[model samples]
Target chain A: MIKTSTQNELIQYVYNELADDACTQLEAAFMHDNELAEGCSELLQIQNLLDTALKSPHQRAVQNILNYSKSLSLQS
Target chain B: MNTTTQVSDSALVSLYIAGNENAFEQLVNRHKNKVYTTILLIVKDTYTAEDLMQDAFIKAIHTMKSGRYNEEGKFSSWICRIAHNLAIDFFRKEKRSPMITLEDGSNVFNTMAFAEDSAEQFQVKEDTHARLRELIQTLPQSQREVLMMRHYADMSFQEIADSTGVSINTALGRMRYALINLRKKMLNSNIAYDKNLYSE
Candidate 1:
């Protein structure tokens, strides 16, 4: 049972775009509250998994563009 | 790797402005992949992505040729800004549906075979991806555009704001809401919220 205020602060903390004092407050809150710690942990995991899964496979496309560049150079 | 060949992007732009066409090719070669991939994720189709990539490069070249490019900023960011605007224009004019329906052969995950996992888990992950995509599509167009630029294109909040002509706070707020909405949607799906599930 994380407090609503603390949970919101923790979500903002994960973005790492918050000010230093806010980050310190989030760290202290996590240390004191089990539910907050667990929720933050779960959200971080979800973020990491989603980031990996959503990465587009564009290596082949990049290679194709490079090949096209070479052919254009040859023609010129 | 030829050290001299790796000229700074600004230098290449200057070269292109001096009527050196090869410099324009260098610029395209450097940014083609990033532009193509960013557009592909936004449009969610290859053909449109290809056309948009070409359009982005052509527009960049035209800008340089016309002497409108200022060397005061990052060339990559400027070109990406152009691509972002073009993608948004396409979205507005097309009014296309955002939902990517997972028909029989359309599942991107079908090619990967997970080892030792139950069919159930695989199905859950796939469903979650599809649901996330649909949810992203449903986002307010502004929020969706910001999310795509921030996450997929790896633009900073400032860059997103500048490119989309919105405030920095608005860009950050849109991303915050986008993630919150996505998390809510995931919670409602069959994929149970388990910290350990992702660690494996």
Candidate 2:
């Protein structure tokens, strides 16, 4: 099993927040450990899936925001 | 070609403050989906989400125009933090519980342009995405909160820890479990985790 610290670092690594030396160490560990590599793979897959799950607001709503911003600027 | 497309959020914020309307437009278009998604996940309704999104942006505009916009952090993270807070405040005031209230994906998924996806491909994408959103709502409140803050709001784990009153390690732990639980639930729900489906 991966140590809790390693798992926490794994989270940071996936999110691109890990420190440089720690990230290098994690990559080195990934090569030697099948479970660690698999865990990384799974986390990445979820991250991508979450990106796809973002939903957009309606077009009119966007237009309203833009128009309001412009109107406010015009008045000032 | 529009060169502002390559401008960073901080640069865009500066341009907007200098009264370049296009800069403000670019900023809104750039972060709108993430901002909208951040709010929608909390309130569980598209109409309310859209309104709250406007309120959030208006608040940002006021701050920027008043010369109070903070330049220390990423503009994406700062704007989304605002969106997240407004959504949470609305949730508290309404005293309504979050439910999987998305009856149709069309309302939430708007006309933002995408690559020329085939009709069949679009349907598959929509179904998988809608299902994933439902699964997100099923996450425990703490896990969901951290996930949205870190994942959707673009806040760093350290920021999440600071805002949520937890240690950075605890924030990271919640995020890890959030991802793990999301994967498990996606598999259980038969949602697509396939990279190929989204790569097109």
Candidate 3:
């Protein structure tokens, strides 16, 4: 099992900010620390899900803004 | 030469200031979706969010035309700050909180533990999308706004703080609480789904 210090290190690894070596260390830590592994895995999943779900709404809202702004420009 | 790729925000602002309306259009094209989505998350309604987004961009253009925009600030960030302020104004006028408070009164950490993890198995299925939208609707206005700024619009905590007049730590704290609350809602709703669904 990954030691406690290593498990803490894995927890501190921000998915977008981690270097390759740090990410690999996180992978190794996850292999040994089941609880930390599960938590990290779940959090990453949640992020992905949220990202996907928000994409369409984001696009639609932007389009609405663009159309509105264009109309305003024409009127002014 | 990929000229568009090389043009900086300051360059675009300069062009717009020089009376090139298309430059402003290009800037809006580049950042509108981000701005709109950020507003949508705060307002939680389609029509009002769209109106606020337009107003934000119009206000930015006015600022530029009036020679009030600072060259030091990034154009997108400046526009975002405008949008943020407009959203706050909206909430203030309505005399309502910005986020949907959780009815269960559970702590964020505990709620996260119970959230569903089915996004892994289904890969953005329609039901999953619906569930996510429903869960977001459950968040308080402040939490929803912070989450949208952080995740959808991809603004940093400092940017959110600058835009919302909140401290950086407060923005981060709201996002932290948002995630926890979202997780809790998902867990409560998805307990009947398969257990190993998220396991690779």
Instruction: Fill in the DockQ of model 1.
Output: 0.20
The candidate scoring highest on TM-score is 2
Candidate 1 per-residue lDDT over residues B1-200, each given as its tens digit: 56675788889888867766677667776776556656755676666776777677667755776678888777877777777778768877899765544333465434333456689976655555545555666667777777667555556677778877987776777776766676676667555565444433
C-alpha lDDT of candidate 3 relative to the true structure:
0.64
What's the true lDDT of residue B179 in model 3? 72
After superposing candidate 3, which stretches have Cα over 4 Å from the reference? Answer: A1-38, A55-76, B1-11, B96-127, B140-142, B161-173, B191-200
Report how closely model 2 matches the true complex, as a DockQ value. 0.72
Model 2 / residue B85 / CA error / Å: 1.2
With candidate 2 superimposed using the best TM-score fit, by how many Å does residue B82's alpha carbon deviate from the native?
1.1
Judge candidate 1 at residue B50 and give its lDDT: 68
State residue B107's C-alpha deviation in candidate 1, in Å. 4.3
The numbered model that scores best in DockQ is: 2
Who wins the lDDT comparison?
2
Model 3 chain B worst lDDT run, 10 consecutive residues:
B105-114
**TM accuracy, model 2:** 0.93
| TM-score-better candidate, 1 vs 2 | 2
